[model samples]
Target: MQAYKQSLKHETFSYLPQMTPEQVRRQIAYALAQGWNPAVEHTERGTPAKESYWYMWKLPMFGEQSVDAVLAEIEACHREFPNHMVRFVAYDNYAQSQGLTFVVYR
Candidate 1:
């Protein structure tokens, strides 16, 4: 008989390099132009949960057309969870699914 064990480490995969504020804003702008709504999430650094299962800090909401609002939320998340990993998620309302996801902080 063969046995297999699944690992639950959050660091199993290397994500894209951490992004800067300008880069994040640019990405958000592009997503918004494409009719995607921005969202944010974060997870504790040493948690056993997979990255995909991280807790959401904010949910996607439409009618947010200002880049400053998105940037402010990103900055707020960074301040509130300095030792955790933070991410940006864009949801496509028309497609009814996530359009893009990126890590903005490590």
Candidate 2:
């Protein structure tokens, strides 16, 4: 029998259907409504888990109230790092932890 091999993709939401732009907008709205700070990050394609720390696109967008603003940043990151995997992360200050995270570009 041939050996089974797992796919290298281990990013969050990788198994789910790729999110449409509208879905992503909704998710960003939800995070904003919850008062979570949005942040953009990017990692090189096929980056190993041992070097999983993605580079931040910029400072976390604290007090951001518009979903479009967050989406714009994601797009900017994608434009700058067209070949990298871009991700969206929401930080919950009340809980002092990450609340939502998903790859937005790959």
Candidate 3:
């Protein structure tokens, strides 16, 4: 069997559309549906009223360095809207395995 780890760190982004939390949750779920597993989700919000500072993300470790594959999906999703930003850090159980992505929705 293959052993892998999925880790995600969330950071505040600009103002999103609506239900930013749910949107991120669904995004993670969708990624899991894409031949990925052990998905981990994390979220952080600046302030309730701060529409431009909500964050959520998904981490998928496919037993290999698949940052490009994972980020590609997320990038495509965020690109759908002209005003959506996403940021996250991905890593494995090892300190040597880690990646960071900062997508801005401007």
Candidate 4:
């Protein structure tokens, strides 16, 4: 008989405590003040894998200047994926693909 080996499971990265609506709003406002465009993304909570890549719910856009607009999008995403992890991403025009991201809900 041959002995079988089992693969070990690893935990994924995550914010220990999720942020609230108010906290998210403040973050959005700060990002806007810094000229960063807001975007929303969500993914099912699980180990990181090709399929676990963040799915964009809304592309980063500057047309809407108000934080409320970004907040609205966040709310919409929450409704769509109430059980999954949702994040707010702020992109700096000069930074191109680089951006600040944080988990707003999970």
Candidate 5:
């Protein structure tokens, strides 16, 4: 199933714990190609929350790709950033817009 819903809006971002800063940026770009929004470090996390979380913007069809259908492609992209927690979301896009942000993780 797709990681995101067609009518819901979601956003997610995070700092790569096991990845280089450049790797993080590349990962986000891969996500966008597959339909996802990547954000930079927490803009409001001056300190720390219960569990450090990154802010992000999500589209309606961020991850609607099917496993049996898109697994190959997804896996190929996943190679860009290994050993890292990935944040993904899908939102509804009524205007058919392709806006995305690929923020590098530190």
Candidate 6:
């Protein structure tokens, strides 16, 4: 008999304990300090491999200095899509690519 292996999807900050609201705010603040734009995205299925499409909350908040605004947007997204997985993304304009991302709500 062959041994069974279970595969689990892994993401950034997955190993850490569930983040509190304050922790999330700190992350957003870090992104802003790094000069990265903050954005919110959600996926119904919440499977990054299978669910290739993720809907953006509104738009990438570029040049945003207010961590409160970013946190508010994250909360709003979660409220609107309670069933979906909400994620926080840090986009780097200079690199023209995503810098960091983590599932904020699952």
**Index of the highest-lDDT prediction:** 2
RMSD of each: 5.2, 3.0, 14.1, 7.0, 13.0, 3.7
lDDT (Cα, tens digit) per residue for candidate 2, span 18-104:
899999998899899999999999988763763377899999999999999999999999999998888999999999999998889
TM match of model 2 to true structure: 0.88
Stretches of candidate 5 exceeding 4 Å from the true structure:
1-17, 40-49, 52-106
How far in Å is the alpha carbon of 99 misplaced in model 5? 15
lDDT of 2 at 91: 95
lDDT of each: 0.73, 0.86, 0.41, 0.71, 0.36, 0.83
lDDT of 5 by residue, 41-104 (tens): 2223133341245443222333444432223333333454443223433222543443443222
Using lDDT, rank the candidates from best to worst: 2, 6, 1, 4, 3, 5
lDDT per residue for candidate 6 within 1-106, as digits (tens), equals 7542222333587667888988888888899999999999988754456445678999999899999999899999999999887899999999998888888986
Superposed by TM-score, candidate 2 places the C-alpha of residue 58 at a distance from the truth, in angstroms, of 0.7
Candidate 6 residue 26 Cα shift, in angstroms, is: 0.9
Q: Model 1: per-residue lDDT, tens digit, 1-106? A: 8443333222312234555677778888988898888888888765344544778886765668888888788789889989878777888889998788777776
Minimum summed lDDT over a 10-residue window in model 1 is located at 5-14
Clashes of 5: 5
- Cα deviation at 67, candidate 2, in Å, is 0.5
Over 4 Å off in model 6, which ranges?
1-10, 46-50
Reference-based lDDT, residue 100, model 3? 29
**What is candidate 3's lDDT per residue for 10-88, written digit by digit as tens?**
2333233433545554554443444333222322333334433434444455553354555565565466533444444
Ranking the candidates on TM-score from highest down gives: 2, 6, 1, 4, 3, 5
* Candidate 3 residue pairs in clash (backbone atoms < 3 Å): 14-52, 15-52, 84-105, 85-105
Stronger candidate by TM-score (3 vs 4):
4
Q: Per-prediction TM-score, please? A: 0.76, 0.88, 0.32, 0.75, 0.27, 0.83
Estimate candidate 2's RMSD in Å: 3.0
Output the better candidate (1/3) by TM-score.
Answer: 1
